[model samples]
Target: MSAAFDYHLVLQSASKLDHALELVWSDGKTSTFHYLWLRDNCPTTLHPDTKERTFDLLSVSADIEPLSFSVDNDRLMIEWSEGDHHSQFSGEWLREHAYAGDLRPANKPRARSWDAQFLKDMGSASFNDLTTDDAALYSWMKQLDQDGIILVKDMPATEQALDDVAHRIDYQRQTNFGVTFEVRSEPNPINLAYTALALPLHTDLPNQETPPGYQFLHCLANDTQGGESVFADGLRVLEDMREQAPEHFELLATVAIPFRFHDETHDIQHHHPMINLDHQGNIVELKYNAHIASVFDLPEAVMHDYYLAYRDLMGRMRQAKYRMQYRLKAGEMVVFDNRRVLHGRTEFEPTGHRHLRGCYVDRTEFQSRLRVLARQHD
Candidate 1:
């Protein structure tokens, strides 16, 4: 049967439910209303409120019956009782409120994968061959998008090179912790030390209201024995969580855990979910930092469950299946999207000197450059 003839609706003229009344709309185009849905969502008594007071439709009597309805121009005038109490609704409004089309499921957008074409498009130029032009930088960024990390080999090992690389993108994010540091004196405790230490896999600046959009680190000197930076695509970790521990994934998605970073110089904290998702529940970002996570404030029962789930998720994150490990050599700079990728380092002995200068740039500017380059190529 055709959809138009599949459903039927009845409307009565009288307010009393017991009254025998004529049906106004025999054509199946009009929507059928459940008595309870109309009564609770009715326009007049339970009308959409301004900020005056909150209303709970769930607490109202579900048994309360809807008496009748009439057509007044484009509106459906509803009468709930023999008394003159009435509610008016536009047909367009009713259609919007009542219709649930198809109810069939669809697949989410698949994450982009890396391939040879992506690598070639990134421009296979050695660091000596790199230039400060739109085409070269765009190719480099496309490479980063494909591989989650890219190395610009043999860049001039100078502070000016760091500035040049950062400025290649149109927009730069000037953090209080702007690049180029040496192991001279005590910087902020939160500032990443140049000394050799195995930093945990994490997305940076979780304490900020909106963390730095992107990060660029230039390898000034990597003569130290072993200080390899490791990168893991946060999106991959989320996909694994979705498959192996759906409940834990759901818990992380729904709950907001707190993060804090404090020292003599700075104190900041905020609550954000680990797996950030879009309104449609597609995973968009990951915010994971073990050292900065504050003690969660929840009920004892919920807290216990949360700890177990958080631990399991972290264990999965640390696995080799999701990681891409590489070391930055001198004159090579790596730029990555802070919101989508987590980065860390393997410790090297502090006996030898190792130094890297870094800075931040807004992601919108980076994407804008990419589009401009793509247009030029087009």
Candidate 2:
């Protein structure tokens, strides 16, 4: 049958459980909804005036039983014996929360690993109309989701342009340094980024409770030599480590290492596993910083194992097969995921001058903007 005419949505079967109900749809999809879930989500559970749930689940017995169930008028109706309450559920909601036997949400894409091959495969777009054009913004945001980084060309070198671009999807996330900051080779700098040195690939602000989601670097001038921007996919490195040494990967993922940044003015500290995982045990975030990583409080034997895993992870990060190198010119900016992609630079000689303006944006706002754009287009 043709796709449009192949529509089939009907209750094929209904079964009751001790505390739940299972329904099979005509499409051969089965969904199980708990009794408590049905009671909490019932339309009448809400206060008519306040529009908030008036039903107190705690007042209901845990052994609440459904007296009868029937599929009528394209809805599944269940009548509970207690309080004589009836619930009519739309099949659409049941399909959405279907437990595909996985603990995590099914739609979320697991992290994809990439390496030096990504250098040629990275996406790029124009900075000229990103703020004004919805299509342009959506395209760039999708690129960031797919590749974890994207380069924009021909932007105005003004700080306003940087702010405009960052604000295109979301407002700037302010830090102790400020909403935005500058990077340059200067005297008595607070961070090593202020000086000319080869910085190993690392995430930014790992010392914070929750690090900023994204980092934007806008190059205003690049008259200096040898300061090439470098990137490495931490997800790729973790995949290789898990394949070569599963035990080391487990150590990095389970051991909570403390990171700190302290000076005369500020002292920031955060403890997080270098390799973070989600409920489904998928790599979600990578936290690493060689500069500010604090001493281990772990026992001597455990510390030895952690050091081996730590040093091995760093060595793998430096492998040529997993690194991407790109040098930004004037009027160019690159935005990257600070959590998943490790970024750094090769040491540069200060022949004349080089400068870049940078800022941070939370991931929530960035993804929200893209979803809104998608809905509008749909």
Candidate 3:
């Protein structure tokens, strides 16, 4: 059989339970669709143009069940118990989205942790291809989403290059610094990034309620004596900590620390653990900025231990094994997940000129564009 015909799902049988409908596929796989779920996702429940959900769950009874259900080759027909309504779900759709056994909807790309070795085979793309081709853009986004960092080369040494690539994904995320920021030695600078000083590996704006996501830094010039860019996968370091030092990892993930960024005009403050984890204990974010990290106000009993944990993680990040040190060339732009990739710089000579322009795109926007491109490719 042809691939498309062979891949098509044909319902072998469908049995209605009290509150759910069970389906048996031709390939012997099964799926259980809850009545409420089926009702909420009915074709009629969504706007034809916008595809937004219009059905309200509260409008139906909680105990609603299917009155009758039947299989028609590749589709499942259902007569709901409420409102004399019916729902038709294609067997192909039901199978692809089956929420039974090992069948589940596809999840967003997961982080692929990396270390110094990543630099040897770093993910990179050409700027011209990304801006001109959808396939190239999708491939680049996938790599970026997986690796949390990438390099885009062949860019013009101009601010427009950075802005064009950023808008290709979505609108730029504006912070207090503005929609875009400059990175060069400046007198009376408000941020250390604007001064000629060595920066520690840290995330930007950990003080904000939601820090900027993906950061794109375009190197306009790099004629300075030093100023090599340094980056480390925060997730990689944390993963090792989880295995080698579980207690220290627990402390960092559990203890919330205060972070503040203030000037004459603005004061932004928020409390987040150095290592933020999901409910399943997966490391989702790392917020470590020694410059802006407020004084620890933990209980006197745990203060000593917290410092030890914090110091251990910071020391690991500085180690050469976890860091990728490179001198970015002009016309090269580096993109990184600001939340998961710790970035820093070596101090440069104030006499020599080094310039870089940067902007941000929220992770949501990046993921949304990726998803749309993925659908088109699929």
Candidate 4:
């Protein structure tokens, strides 16, 4: 047997500095080529990183000049005057750069900073000074969409005010943990007696098949001594995990874990990868609720390893470096992206009173409101 191949030059064009080449097949099909791609992917002393695949052409400046090109028999070569370099393209090179697959869709745009319409909708003062107004509320929602959290101050210290806040955000009062759930210090022998419940840092409704995306808690009364609400940005924790324990991060991103909520009233369970990623595999959300984790059904050999990774992740969650704590005063409400932020509370004295009306809102609704408000400016 013999290794066999056929070669021919189909089309060729050149510029003063850059060139274009096209190759045709026996069936008369054509494929275009750019000299810049060849130069960038050149396997020579000038281009040491052969493995570097550059797909994002948007990053290149418009001022870049094209390189000159030529075809000799089966090989396509490019010559650039900038560095006085030459690159030869092989059949493998053309195949590697060929557009044989579907192009991926563009990434969803994320604002690096709040826009003018967003600020106007949120009210200018609210964006700059956190002032309250109809526009300010709109801006607050935009901020929440961008940062996954927003604080509204000077809200009315009444149940009606809490409901008003919920209504403004278009949040339906979730019945399971409805619009207003009293958070008074209760006596429970099994947990603690006559003391505030030190709620663990976790997202609400982890057991639900479709967990709520946003949570808003308005402080109506806070004459209590302690019970400060702690907020941890789950995305920040994920970044820390990437830097400190990459393997653990990989495990969380790849392994699906079971979460459950079972009681006399309801029994719910679901499985999700601990680190959720967008279509591009970019870290988007982290769901870690040990209390609700029903089981870690890993292979017997890796069971111990899984537990160790879980423990390490929990330790990182507890670190002060990853958490931000602030106590809400009367008439203030804090809303956060429940899917990407963990909330907890410190224990307070039962003698004093602490009350908050909490509610959940779908994140899509919040984002929809923002998009609508953004369009109003246009």
The best candidate in terms of TM-score = 2
Which prediction has more favorable TM-score, 1 or 4? 4
lDDT of 4 by residue, 1-378 (tens): 012223442333333433444565433555655555555556663424665654444444433344556666556666664556667766545644564222112455352222112222331112223323556666667667766777766776667765666666676647465546766543333345536567778877666766787777878777777888887777777777888888888877877778988878877888877777887766767777788898678778767767777788899889876566777788777887888888888877665667787777786787777777676632
lDDT of candidate model 3 versus the reference: 0.86
Comparing 3 and 4 on lDDT, the stronger one? 3
Write the residue-wise lDDT of candidate 2 on 31-69 in tens digits: 677888887888788899999988899877888878888
Model 3 Cα lDDT, one tens digit per residue, 46-121: 8899999988888989988878888987888888788888889877667666766435544443889999988877
lDDT value, residue 256 of candidate 4: 73
Error of 3 at 352 (Å): 1.2
TM-score of each: 0.63, 0.90, 0.89, 0.64
Could you give candidate 1's per-residue lDDT for residues 1-378 as a string of tens digits? 123322333322223332222223334333345556565566654435563324355555555454656675556676765344566766545544543222112434444533223333332345544554566666677766554556676778777876676676655676546444332212233334555468889988777766776687777777666678887777777777788889888888878888998878778888887877887777767788898898888766678788888999889778877667777777777777787778888877655556777777776776777788778753
Kindly report which residue stretches of model 2 are placed more than 4 angstroms away from their true locations once superposed. Answer: 1-7, 27-29, 44-55, 100-111, 186-194
Scored by CA lDDT, what does every candidate get? 0.65, 0.82, 0.86, 0.65
lDDT comparison, 2 vs 4, better candidate? 2
lDDT for residue 291 in candidate 2, whole number 0-100: 90
